[model samples]
Target: MKPSLLVLTSLPDDNRERIAASFDILYAPTHEARAKSIAKHGATIRAVLTNGTTGLSASEVDRLPALELVSALGAGYENIATDHARTRGIVLTNGAGANDDCVADHAFALLLAVVRDVPQRDRATRDGIWRDALPLRPSVSGKRLGVIGLGRIGEKVARRAAGFDIDVAYHNRKPRDGVTLRYFDNLRDLARWSDYLVVATPGGAGTHHLIDAHVLEALGPTGFLVNVSRGSVVDTDALAHALKSGAIAGAGLDVYESEPHPPQALLHLNNIVLTPHVAGTSPEANAACVDTFIENATRHFAGEDVLTPI
Candidate 1:
């Protein structure tokens, strides 16, 4: 019989059909359904497919006594109970490079949208307000950009920066080898040097609220901030205060601390642009993510090492 696989996150119909061809699927994309499915089928489940946001918990892992593999369908495995799964010898994998280009493209979209005041201008134009009445926005080209966590997505963001003639620098735990871009050991220093600060770091307890009030202050009154990574990486309260008080000029966010629901604190601000955490989402990206997961899971089932293990 095909291995039983429980799916925790919602997937497109086509993607679900594709996965169904490989395994016997127990589709549970809702909270109530998840509990019901687990209670009913936990003993037979041999694998799980979930996303970072809809993670498998330690307790959930405990109930799935037969689970041998856990796969996150995206680059992030932040919310997965990785240590617990590892202790049980369950192979863990993620689609790390699957959506990098899509995310990088969205990052630049946010940057351009905020810096050029596109949304606001579009609205003003619709209301018959001309360019002369609106406040001037800064040019995005030739500005200095500071990237946090120079991983696959960050590297793609930097590569896109080259087309705009933007000078790029990065801050990581340490300098990355073969990366000739300027590295800042300190995040605050990087913020001070950059006209634009793009956060692309991972989410977890270690990186929670990494971008707080102090970093926003260092970004200064003329600087713009963009976050394409996890919402937990930037503090929502601090970001709202910064935008309202002119600590930073403006911001564009694809993720926020309060997800599914709009950020209450930033809703009243006109200097910010928000997207519902869709930086890594696109038809092409979704296909790539699914393909990566299938390849990894197939390899794991075949007694081979899974690609992109966390």
Candidate 2:
């Protein structure tokens, strides 16, 4: 008999069909459905497919006595009970590097959209307002960019910045080897030096609200901020206040603290642009992630090590 797999996140029909060919699927993409399915199929389930956002809890893992592997569809596993799962000998894997290009592309898209005031200009032009009626935006080329995390996505973002002649610097827990880019020991110092600040850090308790009022103030009145990382990294209240009070020139966000719902605090601000957390979402990226998950799961069931272990 094929191993049973519990799916906790929604997937495209084609992706679902692909997975169905490998294992017997127990589809549960909502809270209510998840509870019902887990209660009914816990004993038979040997594996699970989830995303970073809809993580598997320790309690849920405990109930699945047969579960041997857990796979996250994205690079993040912040919400997963990793330590507890490890204690039970459950293998954990993630889709790292699967969507790097897609996310890097979207990060630049957000940066340009906010810095050039693209959305606002599109609206003004539609209403017959000419260039003279609008305020002049700053040139993107030759500006200094500060990247918060120097991970795979950050490296891609820096490469793209090169085409615009933008100088790139970064801040991490420590300096990365072979990375000759300027490294800032402190986030405030990086913000002060950068004309554009892009956040690409992971989400977790450690990085929650890393970007607050003080960092925004250091970014200054002419600086712009872009967040392609998890929303928890930047405090929404602080960001709204910063934009409204001119602490920072403008902002662009792909993720926010309040997800699935628009950020209430930032809705009234004209200096900010928001996208519904789709930085790593494209048909090609999604296919890569799904393929990564299947490969990891297949290897795990075959008594082989996973490609990207968390």
Candidate 3:
């Protein structure tokens, strides 16, 4: 018999069907259903499939005594009880590189949309307004683009920026190997120097509100900010104030503090572009993520080294 798996995410129908064919899946995409499923079938569950946002908690993990492997369907796993799982000798894996291209594509889409005022211009055109009536926006080409995290997604963003003749620099906890791009030890310095600041860092306590009032100020009146990272990284209030006061030129965000609810403070702002947290949701990316999970689970069950361990 196949090992029983508890799936906590709401997968696409095709992905769900694929997983069902491989494992005895206990689908629980809602909180009440999750609790009930755990209560009824926890002992039989040998693995869990979750994502970064809908993490598996320590308390939940404890109930599943048979769980040996936990897989995050996407790159981030900030909410997962990683330390607790490690202590219990449970294996953890994530879809680290699976969705990088999709996310990078979205990040560039946001950056271009806001910088060029694409959304606003489209609205103006539809409302019988002419190009002469609309205020001019800055050119994105030949500008300095600063990346907050130089990981897989960040590197891809930098690569895209290059196509527009933009110079790239980054601020990571430490510099990555084999990269010639300029590195900034201080995030504020990077912000001050950049024409556009793009955040692609990991989410968690350490990076909570990392881009706050001071960083926004450093980006100054002419700069723009783009966040494809976690919402917690940027303070919503600060960003709103900056946009309202013209402290920064504009912003483009894929993730925000409010999450399922839109950022109330930024809703009325005309200088910002917002998208639901969908930086990595493409058909190709989703397929790659699920494939990565299956590979990790297969390797772990066969006593082989799991790929993309977190």
Query: Tell me, what's the RMSD of every candidate?
Result: 0.6, 0.7, 0.8
TM per prediction: 0.99, 0.99, 0.99
Native-referenced Cα lDDT, model 1: 0.95
Q: Predicted candidate 1: what Cα RMSD to the true structure?
A: 0.6
lDDT of 2 by residue, 1-310 (tens): 7799999988999999999999999999999999999999999999999987889999999999999999999898888999999999999999999999999999999999999999999999999999998999999999999999999999999999999999999999999999999999999999999999999999999999999999999999999999998999999999999999999999999999999899999988889999999999999999999999999999999999999999
* Worst 10 contiguous positions by lDDT, candidate 1: 198-207
lDDT of each residue in 145-233, candidate 3, tens digit only: 99999999999999999999999999999998999999999999999999999999999899999999999999999999999989999
**Candidate 2, residue 78: how far the Cα is off, in Å:** 0.5
Give lDDT for model 2.
Answer: 0.95
List candidate 2 segments past 4 Å from native.
Answer: none
Model 1 lDDT per residue over 226-283, tens place: 9998999999999999999999999999999888899999998888999999999899
Error of 2 at 143 (Å): 0.3
